[model samples]
Target: MNLSKTELNDAELSRYSRQILLSEIDYAGQLTLAQSHAVIFGLGGLGSPASLYLAAAGIGKLTLVDFDTVDDSNLQRQIVHREANIGQAKVASAKSNLTQLNRLIEINCIEQKLSPEALEPLIAEADVVLDCSDNFATRFALNRACRAAQKTLISGAAIRWEGQLSTYDFRNPDSPCYQCLYPQDSGQELTCSQNGVLSPVVGMIGSMQAIEAIKALLGLPTLTGKLMLIDAYSMMIRTLNLKKDPECAHCSSALTERDPL
Candidate 1:
């Protein structure tokens, strides 16, 4: 993956003027975003907001992966899919929405479930990875791939009235990967299909995922080692510090190899 930044045109600068005016993002940061490629795992509620915001923020390339078709049940929180797209592949539908937002950016649509062989190469080309998949299997696979590729991953989950957002900076030797926080075999999966989610709760978490992704791509401060919990019902937000586990099978070896002693 080329790490070279892209220059903005008059139209792009004008479109992102609001973001550029901010002290943190200015021109250089925006250019960095234009150079970055982000891979998103799911095209459901979380991926909808994350991908949309990333596109609007001017990411140079985006790879969207999903095998499912848009269903009416997803309309409650998955804003990217519309009534007209009920039977279309999610990646294709998402690409349509994202391209309409930013025609200059590149959108790679992968309308199939990624196998281990397929995932590694895609992750190797990304500047950052977002785990928005509903199942634990995909999340664990993504965590391993990101750790091996030394990429930062922004993970988000929402079900019922609660939501969670966090970043696992696997590029940092001391940082904890997702498996350090939740073991692969630890718990049964709980999805929005089984429970229920408020419409905006996912938007809230997915929006935060976008914010962290932009910051991570620009080399700015991010929520890389902290977990944020949201209670949309009570409107309470809490953040907890995260620590790397010495016993974590996936990332512990890297940390051990880097130990100075």
Candidate 2:
């Protein structure tokens, strides 16, 4: 793709000139980002920041999926929504905010919940998937969908001062999946509403999610097969090497059949 014609014009060149200066994300990388589409699973805390940055970064198209509506309580962390947006659909609010951020980008608001039946097609069309949902069921569903579709998935979670980030790419057979690190039967349950979360903690982690998504879209090195943990209270960051589980139901089951070992 011609960077000058397909990616940026004189107007866009003026808009994105600073980013175009980066050697790593020059005209070519910006073009890759501009042509790529990302699917964001939730529109709450993490989704709010992730969508904002991705749009500002010149990602060509973004599909925002969320069934919830904005509420007063969400204002603390969901920076995309405002006092006037309460009761409005989160996707709609997100689309409005994103458009204001970058008019050159296209934003599609899917005001519906994500389901297993609807997962494959969306995952297939996306260059990268961001998991910002607050619940395990949605997260697991996204993981399975990405794995089946062979799409790159960037997952993040934040509660209080703690946050976790990880990337899963099924294209690499050796990369560990979300289920590999946290088994479905591990029986751990947590929710933002119940556990409580800090607003900036979500911002910090969600921004990282956006970074990973951009890197994945540009075919740059990402957090594949690694977990990044953050503690806001102490302002500490830690990276942990993740291993593919031999018995990982999602990844291993397919490997066993293909290898027939």
Candidate 3:
């Protein structure tokens, strides 16, 4: 991150005026946002809102990764795409929308599935990452990358009228990663297509993910050690505390490695 770019210019101050008005994210917070970089691993339901808000809020740089193309089915919740974009790469579509939202920032689009070798450096450079991917493989890879990079991750999922959100700040030794909450062997993966998801349910969770990402960038309190569940059908929200798995292979090993004998 360039320290000099942390200072918001006149147009930036005016552009982000509403956010700057908040005492929590005044001039300094906005500047922090301007200097930060966020990488989003998925560009579907959850990634849609997350990328939109992050771009609109003036995150200095955004790296969008998605191997899929825009399908007509995505219009129901993927707000970042348009009907004309059907068949286009998701990252390209999202980049177009996000660039329109904020041209001052840089947007990098990767239109392929990233191997571990490709993902780690990107994670290492990001201040925060949003795991909006829909599969366990991708999620586990993202968790491992973030853990190794010591970056914060905001994870969100929505399916069948239920949405869940959690954050893992790898900078914190006690923070439980995605693997800790959901082990690698945790049965089959549930997807929006197989189970069905309400459009707004994803919008809600993605928006919250964006909020948590911004807060993490600005040094504010986020759901780092807690999981939030939203039962949209019942119109209820619940939060549960998360604890590190002392014997887990990922974060626990890092903790052990850092501690003295």
Candidate 4:
């Protein structure tokens, strides 16, 4: 990835004028977002709106990873895929839709499953990684890879009228990793297919992930070290502070490696 930033043309400035007008995202912040690369895993409900919003928000580049084909049932919440795209690969559908939204942005599609070796390089190159995947396996893998790469990770999940959001900034020595919250071999893998999820639940969480990713790219305040829990049934939201696990196998050693007594 090139380290240089992209200069916005008049068209781009006009296109993103409303977003640029925000104090949080002035011209400089918009430029920072345009120069950043975001890697997103899974194109289901979460990734759908996350990618779409980020693309519309002017993220310079996006690498979408998903090995699933669009299904008719997914149309309920996976808004990025259309009824005509039932059999199309998720990354392919997402890339097409995202490109249509913002031709100025570069979109990469990965249609195959990625091993940890394949995942780390992509995570390392990304300014921020969005773990929009539903399964625990993929979430743990992404957390581990992001920790190794020292990249910021915005993770989101939703199921059964509940949603979760958090940021793990590995660049900080005391930053807690996902493994710190969910230990290895710990997640029960309760899926949306089994429990059922409200459509907007994932949308809300995923949109928040996009915001956190943009904040991460622009060096702004993010949800790092805090977990936001949403109970959509009652419309309640709560945030909990997260602490680094000194015994965590994934990040504790990295901390010790950097500061050995």
Model 1: residue 158 alpha-carbon error in angstroms: 0.6
Candidate numbers, best TM-score first, in rank order: 3, 4, 1, 2
Give the TM-score comparing model 1 with the true structure, all chains together: 0.95
lDDT of 3 at 86: 97
Question: Taking the tens digit of each residue's C-alpha lDDT, what string does model 1 give over 36-131?
Answer: 899998999999999999999888899999999999999989998889899999999999988988998899999888887788889889999999
Candidate 4 per-residue lDDT, tens place, 97-154, comes to: 8889899889999999998778867887899999999888898888888877788999
Report how far residue 230 has shifted in candidate 4, in Å: 0.2
Query: After TM-score superposition, what is the CA distance of residue 248 in candidate 4 from its true location, in Å?
Result: 1.8
In the range 70-179, model 2's lDDT, one tens digit per residue, is 99999999998889889999999889878888999878988877567787778888989999998888888888878877789999999978999999977787778888
Residue 85, model 4, lDDT: 87
In model 3, which residue pairs have backbone atoms overlapping below 3 Å?
none
The residue-by-residue lDDT of candidate 3 on 1-261, one tens digit each, is 646684788889899999999999999888889888899989999999999999999999999999999999999999999999999999999998888889989999989888888887788788999999999999988888788778899999989999999999988878898988998898998988889999999999999999999999988999999999999999999999998887677766555443111
Error of 2 at 68 (Å): 0.2
Worst 10 residues of 4 by lDDT: 252-261
Shift of residue 108 alpha carbon in model 3, Å:
0.6
Judging by lDDT against the true structure, name the best candidate: 3
Residue 137's lDDT in candidate 4: 85
Ranked by lDDT from best down, the candidates are 3, 4, 1, 2
Count clashes in each candidate, considering only residues at least 3 apart in sequence or on different chains: 0, 1, 0, 0
Show pairs that collide, candidate 2.
Answer: 160-197
